[model samples]
Target chain A: MTAAVRRRAGLRELGLGLALPFVLVVIWEAAGRAGVVPQGILPAPSLVAAAWRDWAFADPGLGLNPYLGTWGETVLFSARRVFTGFVCAILIGVPMGIMIGWNRMVAGAVDPLIQSLRPIPITAWLPFAIAVFGIRDAGAVFLIALGAFFPIVVNATAGARDVPRNLIRAARMMGANERQLLLRVVLPAALPNIFTGMRLGLGIAWTAVIVAEIVAVKSGLGYVLWDAYYVGRMDVVIADMVSIGIAGFLSDRVLVAVQLRVLHWKQAVRA
Target chain B: MTDAVAIRGLRKVFEGRAGAVEALAAIDMTLAEGEFACILGPSGCGKSTLLNVIAGFEAPTEGSASVFGAPVSAPGPDRAVVFQEASLFPWLSVRDNVTFGPRMLGRPKDETDALARRFLDLVGLSGFEHHLPDQLSGGMKQRVGIARCLILNPRVYLMDEPFGALDAQTRMQMQELLTHVWDQARGTVLFITHDIDEAIFLADTVYVMTARPGRMRSRIAIELPRPRSIDLLTDPRFNALRADILRQIREEAIKAMAEEERARR
Candidate 1:
């Protein structure tokens, strides 16, 4: 397509993206009003929006409503777990991946063990997490960390392994020591792939947090999701779901933003 | 000083999946200080193998290499290589790639920047300092690669067909740029290529090698005047050298083809 036609399509995409969500909301509100859909089963978007507004702004009245004016606190709780878990994942995972990738001895000793353990789901570790940490912040953190770690470690290993042999040779020719090659060449070269892994890992961390919060732990958006469901406040449950999505999206956006900044060199290749 | 690089009876063998194959055999060569020498031969003649061995990226099975009277054991700053591909870190800007060595060696940032800028200008990459490898054309990326090696101020440069991947026009242009850069900082360069015109145009001497399990066939000194030009390609002396080398290579190809046919039979 010509540039003008391509741009026109882009504008259409923007319009459609905005319109689609609005259309969904309108259909939902109509269904709720017409009673075509059972209100107890599926709350209208308008009702959920109102509940979210109240939960974010209106008084709690001694926590009677549970969610009232505490939406920010709940979001903060989940966000903190994800952020801490992701940071821990990166701190441990990236170096571990580098070692696993660069050293045959490390790869031989650790790779099989990691590969064997990787297929075991993070949810399976929940009971162990709860048992070990006893239904606290650490338990949720552990679950999130474990969930995020696999993608980060695996991607880091692949990235480090896939480092162009010629670049390493070039560095070696230029008299770079082993440490210099790892820190300067392998790490930076692996970063683009690592960022891809980070984004995927962050998404899993969000899911793990919700799972942990709903079962082994309390407090956070996931706890509120379950709590509101138990009390027959379907509106709050729907609101909580949207809140979780927005939280996850915003957190992923933060990672993408960070990726863009760090990979500025890769970006420069375009222009 | 002794020759910038001296290799005597150098040999290399590779353990291929099929079997052990000799890459280079009984190779003997010397590159004097400030001379541009090209090792030109057919593919798999081990021209690149020789370059790699001299750069210490690979170990020779026999014999040894010495640089400036020092026994060469491993790659050091004094010997920088320009691979066939630029191999500039795709994730680093042209400027950063050029300055990587100095920075890692703990030279202060200002010093590194100044050195990088000088080399960038020297290699005609002054305007492309901030661009990434992917942003540049094949020729431009190779220029950055040259600038990177130039920045190191290495005593010897081992360039393996640095411009071989460029288009015809771009390849000629790179040849000119290389000559220009070589003029600025005269270092012993062991450039490897299969192109006769390229070898003649760039080198003060061209060493022709016989095919696989390669050995030095002959070394011809090009008396082509310095500050050379594209016009020299048509000169009788140039064509004479090209024809001689072409005949040698053609005979090698025919002989190798006959051997292959026999093996197939």
Candidate 2:
């Protein structure tokens, strides 16, 4: 199809996707105004949007609202944590996973330990993190890293293990030594899986950051969410939830774009 | 002078949970330097196992496989291979795939680049340097496979049914291309295939193999003229050789089918 035709199709798809949500929001607003729904307990979509606008654009000096002009800082604080933790997970997870998948000894020595630890939820580590890192950013970052690590490593291991046997033989026949085989053949073969792991790990990092911020850190969207709830600012709470969803969705899209570029050969095959 | 490839009393038994399955039993073969040899057999007759042993991809369970007097132990560039599936690295462009061997051996970049151009041109893939393996046709991918091995300039070429996956027309074209390229870059070759016509056309000496636990049944030398082309398919001598090999392979194919039927039961 032509680019223009494709773009129109994409726009149609977007329109189709927005239809249900738009209708629901309109119904929700009608219900709230008609007092069929309790406004205090479940604010209308308009209320949430209004609150979000003020959270994002209102001058703090003119308003008594603590959330005024705090949206950007709150998003940045959470984003930075997720970024740091996700990077840490990738740095440690990818090589370790590849080694585990490539070598029997490494798999035997490490895979069991990871498997056992993986079953313990990140939420369960909250107390331990608080004990070690003392309710600071370190605690939140630690949880985010720990939460993201499993998927990255597991996916990396799977990627490495799934490399075609013939490709390895072909490389060896081309005079690749053990190290060269791992770096050239095995690593490239495992990349698709590694990226899959990174995407999953990044999602978990976002989750981890929220969980960490809510309980262990003093600032971020997660902290604002809980604080808004305690003070009964339901509109701000809803706005915060939507903000998290958008951030998570945007981050995933970025990772997917990178995956397409790196695995361009794969894209050609699929196309 | 040492034989280009020498296999003596070679055997390969694959040990599975189902117990030991004999693949090649007490096989012996040799190819002189610059000779083009094909092992013709029925499907599942262990012809590929024989080639694998010589390629150093598999160890002989009983005897030895040697290349240029060195006992085969591990696969190396000196014994480059063109696999049945082409098996070009999917991520690499055509040019990179062709130059893989030389680059792996740490050859100079400019030298390998020029060599890549020549070999890719030899395989008629000069215009597809940037195309990824997945973007190429089966015949094109196999051309890259051939070019990669050619760039190695190896002591021997181990081809395991490299054109077996293509359509008959493509296969014939590839055969012609291979012969043309082999003429220019001559090396000892050990080709494995089930096609009677392909064997008759390509081989200097055709070794017909028996059914499972394969053993050599006959060795018929092809006395066809060089610069062989598609026209040779209709030649009386080619048909005679094909007829003789076809009879042997049919018997083995029947036996193999019977064996599979019995196993299923």
- For model 1, residues B98-166, the per-residue Cα lDDT tens digits are 998777788998899999889888888787778778899999899888888888889999999898898
Model 2, B1-265: lDDT tens digits are: 9999888999999999999999999998889999999999888889999988888899889999999899999999999899999888999989988888788878988899899999889889888898899988899999999999988889999999999989999999999999999889998999999888888889899999999989999999999999899999999988888888888888888988999999999
| Candidate 2 chain B, run of 10 with poorest lDDT | B96-105
Candidate 1: list runs displaced more than 4 Å.
Answer: A1-9, A18-21
Report residue B258 deviation for candidate 1 (angstroms). 2.3
Top-DockQ candidate index: 2
Each model's lDDT: 0.89, 0.91
How do the candidates score on chain B by TM-score?
A: 0.97, 0.97
DockQ of 1: 0.71
How many clashes in each structure? 0, 0
Interface root-mean-square deviation (Å) of every model: 1.5, 1.4
lDDT of 1 by residue, A28-81 (tens): 899999999998889888788888899999988888777789999999999999
